[model samples]
Target: MPPTSVAAPPGAVTAAERSLAPDLARGVMLLVIAVVHAHILHTLAHGGAAPSGVADTVTTVVVLAFGEGRGYPMFAALFGYGLASVYARRTARGDTWPATRSLIRRRGRWLFVFGILHTLLLFFGDILAVYGLIALLFAGMLVRSDRRLLVWGAVWAVAGTGVYALVNNLLVADVEGATQVLAHPLTDIATRAMTWPAMAPLLLITSVFPFLVGVWAARRDVLTAPERNRALLARTAAVGIPVGVVGGLPYALVSAGVWAAGPGTATATGWVFMLTGYAGGFGYAALIALVAARMGARRGPVATALAACGERSMTSYLLQSVAWIVLFAPYMLDLAVRVNGTAAVAMGVGVWAATVVLADVLRRAGIRGPAESALRRLTYGPRHSARGAAAGQPAARR
Candidate 1:
């Protein structure tokens, strides 16, 4: 086999961090992704129960605290930064803008494929689908000025978040408020995933804005040279946390009933959440990436584990669905009906912690996380053959 070589697309990073540091951020972000899925499952089962057992109580409190809106927003932010990472690497390597654009397109296609499989076979609650669709739209803006991207991104993100918040809780007296949105599981999932007159443009703007922000951060070398970017991250956090709190809290609260959506009213409050929520979510993405950079790679066991998980998010995310179905399905473990807000959070967190430890173990054993290895092989496994040689890595994953 040819030697295992992982080349940065030119200047993706300094030689110093060509190791596992970036993966650490990826892993923790994946773990944070659980927040939205867990709550959605509980709502499916019990119409959204409150804190139950002692364990459940604590989890509920955390959900109300910051956990609710925290994770997804952060995920969006990372999406932006990661985009930057790629753009920079390519540009540095003398690959023109077109080469990088093609690369992102390919990456987005893979993301879309992964997302579709994830949404259908696993939980209906999958970001990959939405992200994939949005990416197609996101590609159009690659040539826009950074300022223009930011402007349009801000407009769309704000509008989309508002629309979701407004529509999420408002309900008809006949139908169950935002539960109407949840009807037809896969169809709803698909509606959200596909390009549509109703939601396509709105979602594209929101997601694209973040993608652009990531492009900006990457252009600025924020993640690659985090120390220099500290003040920016800090400033973003200052504005973003409160924005997320204000905007994100209501979705969780109304959904959880700390506030009221009323029996029949279509949720109107979703509007307030729009811009603030993106501000919050992107803020999280910014801060988390900042923190991970400071923490560095190969320092902490927890970080190593998180990076491993991130490296294999495709598998880890899908596995999370399988776990939920078996554990909480009526015909499965049926834990969904038995669990409430706080308890549910515990289960989710416990799963997250477990993913970390297991990933850590895999790294130590010189193994890739199950899904990540598959993805790498699928994308890169055949590249070696074109070089007129056997793949340095297995041509096909076993």
Candidate 2:
């Protein structure tokens, strides 16, 4: 395969020049993220509920099949993929390793700051901080060979899974107790902030493996060169989805109370379920890329809208939490107490749809998402005159 070309200077690529796959994948995955989070918030609203009614059972099964343990890893893999691409672009443009690393470190540092604020103000399960921390630790590994990247990824996955299993044994959190903290707005933020010291470790451990795999994928330029890697993408999707679903099935059954298992066995089994998402994440990416390769420049309004959402994913992600707070927070609409599993899922979809529309509007107006603009400004400073020097281009947008 020919070596893929680097992207245009940051802030140079307009909507017309943007690739379809990565953005489209991000757009589609936001819906998945919204649904999984909706389920979490819904569980909190109810103070917890089993898969009882027909609606709950169906919704729970759908989540088990595709939502839970699936979306986050997929997004994490994409995060790594984009991070690796940025590193490649910078180095290929003649930037020194030290300078390139500094660029990424600055970006990651800002992301962690954003994540902290997002968690304290909106959602405790903020992933930006975890991604930032992990990227800071391992972004340099993108320069490693493919074989080394995959080998270490596998190692991290196994070791991290073990760490999670041990943590589960040592610190079994009371789900009910955590949910109750959301009963009042003032206490909710404090309680969620407090849980982070414990929750962050688990998220970090579970995330590293997939993030590494994403870096490996970026080395191949899969998203940028989708036309060159159709067979690989198809094979990944063919194998990943079923394996992820099967591995996750036991946990799904256990979650819905359709299967009986000892607590220790369940914890171990949950680890297995989480690990399979590594495959699922790759599969989702490959499938989306293949679709984009076929679509080419023929995308219509809906596709354009989705790609726009993906382009502005950071903003969309934050906005999703704001929507959740408005509808479910006790100090807000307080609808969590009145909504069921089916209703919550519907609401999540509604919120995601709104974001898609908003993203399209921003694109039409030739505006960047607020968060994306802020991040670009922070990472690259004010855009200088286009000097056309490889060394002078703005940093690649994450």
Candidate 3:
């Protein structure tokens, strides 16, 4: 449970429960994703050669090491955490449950639309539509008992990842026959948009398990009271971080040609990737939640800022697309080659910091961030309008 002083009094949002760590982490991760894509777009535009420099080398190594498989996991897990939160809040209100299925379906639709536009106009590498689909699919698990939710969620996720990993392992393992084997579908927009076959497994590996794990954590009040779960978290990271480092690192490097191997070896290494992801992914989520619980942004500028951003996460996500388009659009300044690997990473880090500052400033002004305000209106507007209309009806005389 949350600290006694910080816990809500049987209702409503609480000041103490707001922590911006996840938002900042999420922003940072998205920024990294942007930078990486910028580099890849440059590569695609210029036949796989980024500008050579010390900065490029460091960026390449760091991106290869830390940027490959981690960010998506974190984002997906956070999404799950959000799901758990919404479900809990709805169930607690004793009000009619929202049409969650319809809600998620609409969200998925928006994601698909947004993702298609993003892929075509800007970057071909996109995950939004698929992530949205997976979220809708996973919504059914919200009401399950904790154990069954965790276990079955894990089963579905692992099975999905295993099948896709098999495909990736077989297709990606070969260097000599790579061109002849198969391209990453469109190697561009078409693949990322509505390629349901490819996306099904990708979603399972990339987002689903972490999401369920997040739901599990929320169930236990793990974030609200992390000190109570420190030992579990420490043990988790101890096991997970190393596995992620030792096992997952190789596959990424192999893909980069550091230790390219056969299909069998690639298949073996892919297991390591998934294992470390589950282990380390769980560890990271728990650790962050615990960190938030203990050293919360309870009553200060930081807390205020993060809470605003968290409330507006969907908005912020969309805003990121806008920000990137403005920054990278060829017609804007034709900066396709100007931003290199290292600079892109730096920009990512910087953008995240800017977002935090922006969040805080928006909070102080009593103005919602553009994204937050939009989502708020979108989410609650219709229901509120309906309620208002009903409340004005004349009472019946008995």
Candidate 4:
């Protein structure tokens, strides 16, 4: 435990203090997330149709290999990174560990609330609540020794992977049968409400390993100072990405109908896919950091726009959910029945591109994302200033 010295809590990080790599990684991550969620929702609405055309087959293969099971781990890792940053900043200002933990838990509580609302009102596959539960449960673990963090992370990785494999083998059919088209908003909300409780805990389990690894990386300032860790980052990208891609190949082949296998073989490949996804997620982050390092201070319009979207990630994510409802819901435009995998992916990309433009507009206007602003207020109280003066830093713009 850290020393029990009390001090004023530090304020939020200013744009100047924010690192490009983390933001850029998040910005790109949202695109992956958008496409994955879009694909999954489309599949569900279509009652899990098999690939019917060349384009659909290609889409299935590529998405299975590089998209599905990849984005969430990266999101979890970044969440851990943010948590560690909060701990470091507060501790550096002489805040007690207990107080810091309370602050984190409080934030978690609100995140859980957000998740619940998101589930009830929009997407049923919301991860915000799972993240909230994780923060609530493991806030104390943030202060554990580096050795302990890695050990426990490994333990969860194995346990969670096994559970995922079992669930995949046992419940794949059930999941496919449980197609949701939002034909009735009330029915959909009730269904999500009933299932979210069970799903949230499982997600927390599968997510903890990557989250802990992220905390470990943050302790060493991995993303924040990519230049200092270029060699390590390079190696991680080199090894992790290929391993992830190769591991995903077996499942991708089966999913795309390019290969036929027994149920047992398919199940085994599913396990392999989930297990190697951690590598893919980490590799993506490392690769993005390397790119950011190379760019240095030269912020082009595209990079700047991406970073802006990343900074406002929560809003961007929620916006995608809104799009899902508008575009796919049976009660809405109901495009899911008409669109194929390739078209759905294209639509996902278009939605993400729209967000990038909107986020850049907000950046130029000096307006914080509405969701971000609300979360900051909930986490730090309405009266809390964005200024870091309590930590002897310059005033920060919100």
Candidate 5:
């Protein structure tokens, strides 16, 4: 006979109940995120320029091939996974879809507000607002059938590619000139604010497809059932990563000056590279899931620390931007010109290391990250929490 299962109260997942794969993936990817954002921010701060030498060329190629388009998609996928997981939990707790959707929408609203503030205050490259906006824009669609989800994902990908190609073609000449304003402390903020409107659509175009795929994965409980899906994960990792790299090679070449970048070149080739991010993103995540499956449920300092960082990813993500503003913004340290790509990457690593340590300390103290706690409080009011606890509701099985 199969063993009987018990559910925990809504939103009360214990440490043991959480899957290690998702958390580990998030934690590791944050470093990738840091480095990628730092690179772009640095380039924008100084104005874009082609890499000059073999060493710089190699570095730029490596980053473009493996890091550039990959990080954000992976992060967005994880976001979808998390959102679906939460929705599953709420439904399993006997909460009506209306109630659950209401709470999630509330959370999404806060996320948008947070994103706006983060962008205005620190970095124009902020993605939180994009994610927030995505949630609000697509809330109703999330509950669509898996087949429909796949269709929508495909539609988004195709449409996004066309849109990016058009936009890139138009913006090719302006890219370098626009970024030059960042060189001035007084003009940087105004430049960023002005440019943000244009960035919003591109953000959606780049992120929506992967976000939907993540939602699909969550529906299948892919990460949660990694062991059972090892073959699938292996296949995906093997095929996706290589194909993604191949697709991104042109961008790497352009960045390295091996292939010259011009209006025609960027317009024709840029979208090809950008669109490949989806594959790389999914591949990276699958590879991580495969690794986590092998890791089992082992507990140690490294694992704990990584998991903690993942759990508090929102704070860590924002903190990375904060570090960038402090170190690179002209109004602050104004080190953009001083720091080369390699040096900026090193700085990003240092910042990521700091966040990992902070996360560990908070974990040990049994304290939720400030942003996470606030988000939780905002999403689920005190009254609902009390009701769930008093009812002794079982947790979601997945």
Candidate 6:
């Protein structure tokens, strides 16, 4: 039976209680995300033209190999990790599964709301809603056995891969048109509102496997205590990164016009690219964890900066969305049409760098991200929310 008491769980995890690796991974993941979105917007704006020069081709290959499909899965995994951490913290405090589940779903519900507003106001490629929906549906899985988690993860992975492959084959040509920016702001908003609903579910399918894997890893404290899992992290990095890069090469080549491929070959390679991207994403996380393990309590400026951005990842992410709208939207600066692929990539890096600095400033100011604060408040209610705010502890999941 569920615990009858409806008491709130403890306040958010204080700064000292937070680990460095996951935060670092999230910080780095945002850079990749920025690059991918910038490139996609560039391509869509240009009507999916092939790379125009050496720099553009190089950017295409690298992003396709290590960034595009790779970043989100890593984020998803981290999301799952954060979710599991919350569950563990609450359960350890004698909170019942039922009560914890409610807390999680509440967070998820708010995230969905945030996602909706984000799409309407900024970017249509928002992922918060996708994660939110997953949490709502799968909160019960938190209490399930490890075997069940793995089995379900594998199931979703297979299904997601097949769906991606099929979608690629059928809709590859239509995708550019679907995401094209309309001239009017109202039209763009309406289009995004229409498109997001369809895209969210598709994203959910591809994202679930990584999220579940993250949950499993968190249960074992894989990131928090990376030194203890050194061998495992090393093995994952050794294999996963290479697999991801190599698997991505064929599609990258085709996309860059370096290699010619018929529709059938392109479709096949696209499937391989996406399938290996999961490995790449997991590999990236493991690699980051290994790096964090080596850093070992040394909070250097660079690491501190990245971790700061990571800690406020949601805010940083939304900031990027705003940048994108200002820079790329037709009604705004419309730089997408003005810039080449290489320039777009550079802009992405620049934007990420700016956010890093901004995040560091926020860290120095000791002000939690407004988005994070709002989410904590909505998830935990005003009473506990006030306490968390006073303590400046961020919510478990970024």
Q: In lDDT terms, which candidate is top?
A: 6
TM-score of each: 0.78, 0.91, 0.74, 0.93, 0.90, 0.94
Error of 6 at 22 (Å): 0.5
Instruction: Give the worst 10-residue stretch by lDDT in candidate 2.
Output: 385-394
Comparison by lDDT, 2 against 6, better one: 6
Clashing pairs in 6: none
Task: Indicate the worst ten consecutive residues by lDDT in candidate 1.
Answer: 389-398
The weakest ten consecutive residues by lDDT in model 4 span 388-397
How does candidate 4 score on lDDT?
A: 0.84
- What does candidate 2's lDDT look like per residue over 132-213, in tens digits? 8987888778788888887988898988877876675455345643454366777988987997888788889889888887
Please give the clash total of every predicted structure, in order.
21, 0, 0, 0, 4, 0
State the lDDT of candidate 1 residue by residue for 189-304, as single tens digits.
46444523333334444465566666666667666666777888788878887776765565455544456566333254455544565676656656765777677543565665
Task: Sort every candidate by TM-score, greatest first.
Answer: 6, 4, 2, 5, 1, 3
Residue pairs with colliding backbones in model 5 are: 7-394, 7-395, 8-394, 8-395
lDDT of 3 at 315: 54
Tens digit per residue, CA lDDT, model 4, 1-398: 12212222363665556789998998999999888888888888877756778998888888878977888888899999999989999898898999899899998999999999999989988999999998999988789999999999999988897777767666655666567665888887898888787677668888999999989999999999999999999998998888888998898888777888787888888878888989999999999999999999887889999998998899999999999999988888889878898899889999999998999888776677778778877888765534322321221122
Model 6 poorest 10 in a row by lDDT: 1-10
Q: Write the per-residue lDDT of candidate 3 for residues 1-398, one digit (tens) a residue.
A: 23422222221233234344555445445555555555544444333443467666556655645555666676777767766776677677653444655555555566666565655544444566666676667677777788887787778666856765787665443323221101232443344344445544565565777777778877766655567778876787677656666666766555555565787777767766765656655555555555566665353555445545554455555555555555555445434457666665566556555666765565555454454333333444645433322332211000
TM-score of 1: 0.78
How well is each residue in 1-398 modelled by candidate 6, as lDDT tens digits? 23212334362565546789999999998999999999988987887778888999999988898787899999999999989999999888888888888889999999999999999989888999999999999888788899999999999988897787667556656764454677789998998899896788878999999999999999999999999999999999999999999998998998888988888888888878888999999999999999999999776889989999998999999999999989999999999999889899889999999999998888887777789879988898887776655554332223
Q: Stretches of candidate 5 above 4 Å error?
A: 1-16, 178-187, 382-398
Off by over 4 Å in 1: 1-22, 48-61, 170-205, 261-268, 293-298, 377-381, 384-398
User: For candidate 5, lDDT tens digit of each residue in 200-312?
Assistant: 77887778888888888998888888998899899889988997899888878886678877767766667777788788888888998998888886656787688789978
Highest-scoring model, TM-score: 6
